[model samples]
Target: MGAVRVVLVGGHESADGADLAPVVQQLPEAAVSTPGRSLLSQVRAALAGSDAPVVVLPMTWGRDPVMIAETARTLRWVAGGDAHGRVALSEPFGTTDHLIALLRTAATRTATRWPGSGLVVSAPRASPFDDAELHRVAHLVRVHGAGLEIGVACVGEPADLTLAVDRVRALRPGHVAVVPAGFATACPEADALADVDFVGPLMTTSAVLRVVRERTAGALHDLGHGHDGIAAGLDADHGHGYAHSHGPDGDHTHTHGDHAHAHAPHAPHPDPHATSHASALG
Candidate 1:
């Protein structure tokens, strides 16, 4: 059997590319692209020369339309314009539940700095994936950091940083944690907001990196052409089983392996007669 050739398709950001490179380097045949090149072409070339199954790993924050499109195109090519393939597309790194857990941990670690109240601010221009992640983090804040006030905001959205600050300030929070839900500082929105007192990179935390590496390893196992192995590995690692079924429109539905618990961010006030109206934004 031949070694699988994995092609990691990352963004135009050098830092993300750099972070992803070392993760995939130990593979038998792996390559990364320079910032600002034709990612599709690079992936195609990598595939053309490989006798082993090709795996395309998208090293992005999950918002770049270009990366999404390129990944789709590569999947199509590998699938032979059919529904299956010897080569396959792994779920983008950001979408995994493991990644979500990591984000929650990162948020919690940063929130510790703020003693009284905490806020999780998502970059306004973050990708849909990032937004979804922020929602997950918000839920975590409510569950794990009870008694802390929580608020959510985006840079360009209706609820920008100022809006988030206003909400937090209204509660007279002692500390504020700004979580940049982005993989790189390439986006001006992320860079501008990261200057806040409590700020941290999206995937810089050790937990997040561990999940990324595990997911990458899973991708490689899948590309080796063993469906059962892939599912089993993911299930065992994440403690959540995977299931796929076709809907009416021939669309695929994905079921995650684990269940998440939802909890309120603040505890009930001591005075039973007192009215509490604090809202935890998800």
Candidate 2:
């Protein structure tokens, strides 16, 4: 069978040099598409001349449902307002379960490097569910004796980096290491904390690349065999039940089972050359 074209749908920051570049360079026949950018144009381009399917792997840690929804919407549009039979979304690069496993190892390493140090796992503020998941991850790490104690922090929410560090500091450990989750870059504000060590982003790791390659291979195989692969499951399971705060607009909630809502309209795709150079993703 011919090689399937692989397109990575990354977060808003995925286009940044330090985040997705290394991994993309390592993969063969993979391109990137991000929302509000050239996601439409690039995926269209990927499907233009190829009968083989284009598999889209969302580069999320399963914390950002909006990104996932948005990618699904874009894929549908690229498929001409229909189900994406030609273009398919594979499983996310890293699920919440994967994050827990990755952070467990990181916690162990941090504890070994700095004995008795409290650990802090931080990610960009996504949702209440996201916050809860981080806390759960911290609890599991502590329960597993991966660290002396662990704390949770979100980049933009109330439990910001400093506040989470303070919560950990209340334990009076030997030192502290703030481990970032979700993306490849450490929290930008991590440097302001005195005497605290910051770990690198997990997106740059070999495990992540391996996951991407595996997801791509599976999607390609499914397409070759007349199955839709993960995209079929995603379409059936797209209903998400969660509440997200929208600044002063207050929180909007959605329940499980058939639900409908509107997303902010996106501008139409630009011309080909401009689409080729758009930086948000594709």
TM-score of each: 0.54, 0.73
Backbone clashes for every candidate come to 3, 0
Superposed by TM-score, candidate 2 places the C-alpha of residue 272 at a distance from the truth, in angstroms, of 39
Encode model 1's per-residue lDDT on 168-221: one tens digit a residue: 767864556565555533334433543345455555434444554555567667
Error of 1 at 215 (Å): 3.1
Go through the candidates in order and give each one's C-alpha lDDT: 0.49, 0.64
Q: Please, what are the lDDT tens digits per residue for candidate 2 over residues 47-130?
A: 776766788777776665567667766665565443356766676665555666677778888877887888888766656655
Off by over 4 Å in 1: 1-5, 9-39, 49-52, 59-70, 81-86, 94-96, 124-133, 157-159, 185-195, 205-213, 226-282
Clashing pairs in 1: 124-155, 240-257, 241-257
| Number of the top-ranking candidate, with TM-score as the measure | 2
Error of 2 at 167 (Å): 1.5
